[model samples]
Target: MMTLLSAPTSPYVRKVMVVAHETGQIDRIDPVFALANPTKANEELNNQNPLAKIPALVTEDGAIFDSRVICEYLDATTSTHPLFPRDGKTRWQALTQQALADGLLDAALSARYELLMRPEDKQWSGWRDAQLAKIERALDRMNTDIPDTLTIGAVGYGCALGYLDFRFPEVDWRAARPALADWFATFSERPSMQATLPRD
Candidate 1:
């Protein structure tokens, strides 16, 4: 079984875990908790992923970094459910939605890092506000284009929304985006989602 370097509260890791469960490939991976901090040194994680990111898959050939690439690798290798749509407009749509959702996650993480990693005196409210604005725009776009298919787009959106609930409870992301919230309400009930909810 391949080893998955992960943390329960990492949204990227949760995305990979959700994909594994959804594709019926969970048994093929061994989830191992990893303590990765950008400010601190993690030799093992650095060796596997130069960026020291989570959800790195230690595969037979080598290690894979980043959630999008890892998720695509899983989608291509797994045949049980096939989370990615085959070539067509649907494929492009799914990939585009995935990119949008991942961008939301990136914006959210950036804002979070500004607050959490930077010193209180050095933290810039302007930077945080800019990132938060990006998140708001992404949420609005997702509300307008909520996907109906079980594709990587759905998985990416689910994980991104889940991370918002986990990290930014004070920010009412659902209030202005009722349609997106309703879709997530239904998506969050899936077994794969239930199994990988981000935790402290």
Candidate 2:
């Protein structure tokens, strides 16, 4: 079995887990909790991933870091490439959508870290505001271009929205984007999403 340095609280890790679940590779992955504090060090995780990031998968061949790569790897393991389209326009669209979702997650995480990780005196509201603004812009784009199929893009969107709900409920992303909200509500019902709910 492959080992996954993971923490449920991480949306990126959750994205990997959701892909694993959807691709029927969940049983093959052994999830091991690893705290990935940017300011602190995790010896075990650092050994596998120089970046010291969670969701790093330790395969027999080697280690795979980054959620997007890990999700694609998991999707490739299955005979049917359900999460990723084979080729053509749909493929590029799905991949681009996934990137957008990841971008949203990046900004959201940055905003959270700025407020929670930085010391009171060191915290900068402007930085957090900038990150939050990015999130809002990303959200607007997602609202206009919601994913209509079950692809990596859909999984990424689901995980990102789920993270917002779990951590930044006060943001109220649903109010302005009903269509995207509806899409996510349906997507959240998937077994893959249900199995990999983010937690403390």
For candidate 1, the 10 contiguous residues with the lowest summed lDDT are 78-87
lDDT of residue 17 for candidate 1: 90
Estimate candidate 2's alpha-carbon lDDT, on a 0 to 1 scale.
0.91
How well is each residue in 51-158 modelled by candidate 1, as lDDT tens digits?
988989999999998988888898898776667887899989999999999899889989998998898999999999999999999999999998997999999999
| Candidate 2 lDDT over residue span 85-114, tens digit each | 989999998999999999999999899989
Q: How many clashes does each candidate structure show, in the order listed?
A: 0, 0
TM-score of 1: 0.97
The lDDT per prediction is 0.91, 0.91
Error of 1 at 135 (Å): 0.5
TM-score of 2: 0.97
**lDDT accuracy of residue 39 in candidate 2:** 93
> Which residue pairs does candidate 2 place in steric collision?
none
